[model samples]
Target: MRLLAELRRRNVFRAGLAWLALGWLLIIVANLLFPLLGLPERAVRNLALALLALWPLVLWLSWRYELTAQGLRRDAGAGAANPVSRRTARRLDQLTVALVLMALALSGLRHFVLDRAEPRGEAATGRALPVGEAAVDSERPPAVPADPRSLAVLAFANLSPDPSNAYLAEGIAEEILNVLARIDGLRVASRTSSFALRAQSHSAREIGRQLGVAHVLDGSLRRQDDRVRVSVQLIDAATDQPLWSDSFDRELTDIFALQEEIAQAVADALAEPLGVQTVRVRRATDDLEAYSLYLRGRQLFTQRGASLEPARSLLEQSVQRDPQFAEAWAALAATLYVMPSYYPDAAQTSFEQADDASARALDLLPDLAEALAVRSRIAADAGRRDEARALLERALTLEPNNANSRMWLGLTHLEAGHVDAAAEAFAESHRLDPLSGIHVGWLGATELIHGELAGAREHLERGHALGWRGPASAWLLKLALHGSDAEETARRFQDWLRDDGRIPEAVRAVHHAVAPAITDPAQRPAALATLRQAVEQQPGYDWTTLMLFAGLTDAAIEEALRPKPASGQILLMMIWSPVDADFRAHPRFAEIAQRHGLPAYWAEHGAPDGCQWHGSPDPRLECGQ
Candidate 1:
């Protein structure tokens, strides 16, 4: 009776009780009468708004009313004795008031009651480990290795004797790899690695071990001209168990449809225990011939050089044959962008066509991964990393396994010195395709960014031994960090580049030792002379000429970094941006930016314009804007 009298006498207590009563009354009324309101949610909101208005009123009133050990004081100025003045009791009352109100609000929310069983995705079993797991595996799997978050599709062997039609078989395998990569929680290996493994006959265990993938895909392809045949078998490398397998037979025109069918099937088979959520849709290609041309264009796009002209011609034919072909249009746009980004000298007219084709592709399917990835590249090259990332994120969401998007995004991160992210994206690309020299090279470089010389050397060695070339990434990483230590640099240079799978020894020495460091006008000209001479003597253009060209602090490097180089051009000198920490503080980076037509802060992020190079201006080879 004493406590009840005290509570009633206190205005704060009285007000708290009144608010609680009012709040309950409002909720009960709303729940019972909400359906009558056109917007029940709004009705509830209005009630909440009304209640919110009471908080300040309480605070203001409470400030003027104070309770003491002997008295209750009101603003009226008469300090009259009324109740206890236990500060702890007052604090407990306030907390209790808040907790009760919060509990009431939470209990009323309908969605919070989750009675439905949560979806258990493929994470339960069929998940494949990422490719960069290979590097971690290089250190050996932990005592109990955890399952991987990604996977790579290695080389699917060619069963046919007609090597001329090798493209047909590999194309099917590539499509499957692309499909698996598209799933949200899955990472497919790079095309370079998958293609390189075509020559090898490694067991699933060995291949999986080397790739650091928990799962490995192995199969064979055969083609009878217009008729194509494919077989794909998915295996769990950790236990060497065959998870799923499928075979496809289709005419050249029906290849796209067939590829999708295989992809959908494999995804289903891999979904259960592994628990990945996926949505598969098969939209028919009205023009089968046009689709075939798109596939052919993709193959040529990889080879690049003078052949891209024919590729564009073929891609144009494909779109003309089927104007609604989103894949063909996307492929066309991708090839078209390669020129300015790679061969700025290529007729600029193709870019106009590519631009138009990309727009058309998006019109057909706004969420198309291929179209989005191509657009992202266009945005990135134009110095819009934010827009590019937004597009690439959508592309990744639509199709998680796009090598081009992954590489570009990874490179963008690398340029910003986000070494770990770059490594992760590259690792995913590698996980989806272990045999790719490109993925290995990028991974090696990412590791070297943090000066992980050993990791870089290991990946570089794997890349070189897999046919990436010495002056490729392996040679640069090993020699660049080794500095001008003549003996060590010479030994590494000789051991790796002395033959580069096969080239002249006397010619290779000059590039390995002297040509690399000579940046002076006199030395550069002489170095170029030797490189040009070496290119002439060699059957295939080696990495030496490319390396010399790469060292040039020229605007031309921006254009050179673009994919689809001239067939016989120097393979060593890939242009684009550099991630070297040394040049980060150099003043020349500004000049390089100005030369490439980049903004004042090209690589810097957070811009109002559409182009935001990873959202910031990099201090290296400019943003190539």
Candidate 2:
């Protein structure tokens, strides 16, 4: 009891609490402030560690010292005059009160002042406003072209007794959306943008305004035993009125048919404005288990990362149960194609498997838009630019709002050096899928390569805000190196590497040694040599990509054209922005171009804008074989 009283008298407990609260506040401040200030994330972590290290020292100081009216002093020895004088205790009380008030003030300022005026940088200039908020500036955005047939399908509410069946509801909405997207002349919203608005408190009218659609579709789902119940409404965006509403209760076996029924009904109801007659949709599979598994796999595939293998497994099961499930095969193919980009070690087998699955999808449903899109990507990967473009055009004709096809088509255009066409395609994809970081990042990258610094920074910043790391970070690092301070560039490069995941320690060590400052021109040759050797020793997609960015395009091309380590990496590099003009003029370019039918494509479609030499079109070099 005496010890406790002594601690209180000395204000040790108060000081400890004050220190802890202050430390927490500092951490919160640092987290919010660092990125805006262009400081490394590591800086925030180091600050946290430093604060923790000071905790024991704070406690020790508190225990040994006492505040007095005279000044701060060491506590008196046991035999000395008692230090607990009335003046001293009063001063301690005053100090504690002051500290508490300061903490409260800081909290209030951070929450109220800093929160509202937070520096998100210039890229936030054109960001979409929150629901219900009017534009803050006088310059109104150009009015969206009103398309009465345009609609967005928000995620269905999971109202089942077991909320875990949320995946089923999402799958149902997605399937319906896919069906609607296939209707000619219908401007259906991309699933990414529509689903992202699901949890917002926005009214249908506000949502329509934001999505640039005339109608909004939302619904609820409930599942019990082998039965499912769904309630859906189609609302007019301008008036917030339900234009059509319905409910369905059916056996789980009939879910596929139910989706078809819903899609057809919606199409038929909007046929007047849509200018398209309702066509009966076909169920991809009749087996209930296979259909359910397919939906689950599709959902998982969107999540990417660790979800990929499980999605592949589920998709395999889905196809095994129903070989004629064209959508499942297409989805599986798409997943396989993208897997190698994330897991380079799986590059070889993944592409081959992707090709096989795509073939199966085309075999089952020759005109399936999704299947065609995947096939188009494979064709591009094989350097068949003409074939890829034709396939993508066909896919777009069938599903104009298909963002994936549009994005891939943009890449094909980029490969042909058609800068304007590439920009248009990328812009269209971004319009359809505004929330997709990848779409926005690519658009920004196109701008960056074209020397539109201001526009590039805006989109890049927006991309970074919307889950763009990895390649986007590398691009940002490149930008920093071009214009910003050395320290900022290094910090961004570190962040870029984090996204590459589990690079070999030896490679990292050698990279650090040879390229301590990658932006430095003098060190580039040595760094490229080191990176080339490292890539040879351990064939990695990232290192090869790094080499390409490091101005070692010759080495990268040689590595890519090798028979071993076959992956889509070569195709990806070929189509990326800032095309290697020198390499394109090389004799080897003619061999590859002829093999890919590039000359024929150019003959039919005209040479790309970038295929020029000596101020005239490079007929016998870039555009001609």
Candidate 3:
């Protein structure tokens, strides 16, 4: 009874409550402020931990000190009878009540107001309203229900004695997938997602659930001498039960016929349920060797990076063997078109070759969707925006389910500054090919530019995890530097760059030199010199992003203006995105836009999402800040 009375006299209970209330309020405020300020989650977590650690100190101080009119004074062991002690206790109670009420009100404000009003993910990043447009409701439409007729074609197992023939099995499965995709109502999971899941050894049920597919096709192929054997099973993904099974033994020369037979059988099995009417299997080439080479090249092409050169070589051989192969020609065109992005010196030659090849493919098969899409990309790089868009539209109309065409369309839209259209195209491409790291990475990059930080982070991390190392890495590093502790983020990126083997050695060196300037203004001079030297030594890599990250806006603009054979798609996207607001606001930006032909394109298409054209005495372009 004496101990309790003494503690009360010192107002320990009242002081402890007040301290806790104050700590709670601080935590709530930190939670609300940190993300808005672009601070990392770790900042909030550390704040909470620091408050916890301070609890004991606060309690000790409360016990040892007394609040008086004269200010905090050492406790003089006054009993409850002392008017000062009683008064202090009453004041502590009032403070605690006020803190609690404030915390409650803030919590309510966050839950009922902020949460409801704040934009999220796609809605936030999809598009910014045009200047002077009324602010409409930002709510997204309800999601469409998943198609029940969807199917995922898993990579076929290679049962051949020579495991090197694995590409044959994969090629066959992809051909079937392509054939099924052409069916009007049939939804087929893309090769990237299906094959990736197969590589991970996911079961039919899991693959179906993850891919939003109702059916799964699994198969194995064995090839010996001039003969081949294929066995396939179609499973009900929901129950993992075999819906259909088949086996075929045929001469290697009959491979196309076999593929057609298999595709027709699968389509027939699902025709009644899916309302699929026809399955048209188009043969790109009759030459077995050419087909084999094309398949191998395509496999390498999909891997990207270090494999691109080999893919190009193999694809070139495929075309030589079968000059009339429209599909192979289109694939070759795409390979050549992307070479400049990885090897800039080849830009002019590659673009010329790509244009010729795409034209050849179109000549061979005028309706080939792949040829149309690849040609569109070539046109987009050449500053023929309207032509590119027309080509993409035609390709999409012919093959509505073509993820590659969709991705190209998205890029075209982005280049035109049609953010909403680009976002829709990218989202649809992602839905059609969820496991494609490039698609996911591009979507995330778009989100980043649109200011959807959380969505960008989520998709970028996922893309990186799936082995996309291009723009995703740079964008993620940019996000990290934008965080509360930029130095720490830069250090971490430097550490990652040291170990990453995907980037070329020369490009990696430049990245290392410039990365420091992103966070440390003192390093800018040395970093800029190194970066400029790198631009000369390596003509293929994008140095503009590096300059932007380093806060050398003028340098970035100059680099962007330099004539390069590579499609300046990335540069255009970076400049138009909100991240480069300062770059766009520069007085010289109008000149850059005119040089890049954006002014003409905009004049025909109207001003871009956030930009406007001012005519008359002072002709200039203005973008929203």
Candidate 4:
């Protein structure tokens, strides 16, 4: 008791208490700030560890040192004059108390004031904010459904010394995620959304809440020589409690078995029994190097724009290394199919290569969902509406959660003029991959065509927030112009011109002048003249769309019906354009029907809602004719 009293007299306990409080506050602040400052989660953890190591040193120093009239020095002997005078000790205690109170106050402010002030519900509403969507709700619950089967598999950590083995770790985690996604009754988060949060310093519970998943599977991998060590844990997001965990050390050849075991364990824990046929864990190839190269290619392909060329190169290398890898072929085909849009100079060759690769993949695996989806996209581009729809439907039947298939299916429905069906397919695609900007942007476009102006704006803004700048900007400008908000429309158009480098300066200047004229009937002649000039310079969708928006219906239809280099894109524009009422009602609409082979298209498939055929004198059906 006397020793305790002596320790109190020296204010050692008070100092330790204050240090602990301050350390806790520092950690809380660091966790909140590090991500904003672009620091990695590892940096925050290292900061915490460093602070912890300093705690004992601080306590020991407090125990041995004392402030005195003579200056700072070691504590005197117990019997000797207490080096710290009574008044000095009291002042020191008061100072420590102040420090503790300050730390507590800061912590409270951070938790209650700062965190609560963060944004929320932006996914559905699309309110403007300074930070990313993750900040929109710092403390609110995630938007998960009550299914209880929802899961998010986070990116696995690369613990290997080489660091280049990151592809292997990600491949393992992605394979497991794919397996889980294939199982029915499971609501798995998309790989893009799940992996996007890998850098944030969020806990398992926070990740679960944000992703709206009841459970989270997070793990790490360490590759050494011929063996690999993998560790994974499944946690209940609500309580932050681990439901299951396991570690595996196995040779590289056994990696597929390990992934299946992990996937099965997760399914079993959720009380969902895996069906025999549902487990399609076929090994892609025995060549690990080829598999690694394929994973790299897959990652690049998901980037979706400028990365297409490099992605194509990697996939080609992978297939060359392992000619039997059907997945690689499918992925290569998908890449080439989209490459023409990015690299227009090679458009003809790109489609041919895509066709060959997709055909080869289908030949190798007749029912491969990925291969079917790629072929479906090619058919859709070729104006083969029936074939595209059938292929996409089959692909979706094989993999119901395939967002890409759903997106393409939506496009095919739009092409066939089934607006309602197209809307449903786009909605499903958006739900399956809510964080994907392109998907959400397309959903917004569908909503716009359906004449849901407010709904379209909400989704377009959300898509912009999610990093789909190009498509979202175009759609949002349309929304503004559709509502007759001339200022907003012009603002968006000018911004687009500034950001889209591919648009020629002359084109941008013409659009800038034409934007404000869209809202005023008096300026129609000037806008039409500007649009005509722009179309002459670049006969494309944007120019065509501007003409339609500016009330030059005849000119717009003429540009669309004209035989041109971008006829494929023009056909798509005609399919998705919601404001084509005038064009649809024009007497010469039959020209479009005839030029595009719409009569045969409708006969092979059903006609879209607006057009109906009577078998007599005219097999062709036009809403106007």
* Cα lDDT listed for each candidate: 0.55, 0.71, 0.76, 0.71
Best of the candidates, lDDT: 3
lDDT of 3: 0.76
Cα lDDT tens digits, model 2, 1-625, are: 9888777766667777777777777776775665444444466778989988998888788778766656668887444575455455565566666766766776677556553342111011122322111221112222865589799997777767786687798899988998898887888888877776665445666667767889888777778898987777787877776677666778998887888888877887798887667656676777888988988898888877777899999999999999999999999999999888667678889999999999999999999888899889888877677789999999999889888789888888877667678888989998787766767777887787676878877777667666666667767765665564767766777777765443545567765654453556677778877876776687553454555445565665675555566545344333334434445665555555555566777777777675632222433554342
Tens digit per residue, CA lDDT, model 1, 36-100: 22222345667877886886677456446665545545634224553343563565467667757
lDDT of 4 at 33: 70
Residue 214 accuracy (lDDT) in model 4: 82
Clashes per model (N, Cα, C within 3 A): 41, 0, 1, 1
Model 1 stretches with alpha carbons more than 4 Å out: 1-166, 214-257, 276-279, 304-310, 339-344, 347-357, 417-420, 465-482, 486-588, 591-625
lDDT of 4: 0.71
How many backbone collisions does model 4 have?
Answer: 1
Q: Which residue runs of candidate 3 sit more than 4 Å off their true CA positions?
A: 1-146, 481-484, 492-513, 522-542, 564-568, 615-619
How far residue 602's Cα lies from its native spot in candidate 4, in Å, is: 3.9
- Rank by lDDT, highest first: 3, 2, 4, 1
Instruction: Kindly report which residue stretches of model 4 are placed more than 4 angstroms away from their true locations once superposed.
Output: 1-145, 272-280, 498-543, 566-578, 591-606, 610-625
Clashes of 3: 1
What lDDT score is found at residue 387 in candidate 2? 82
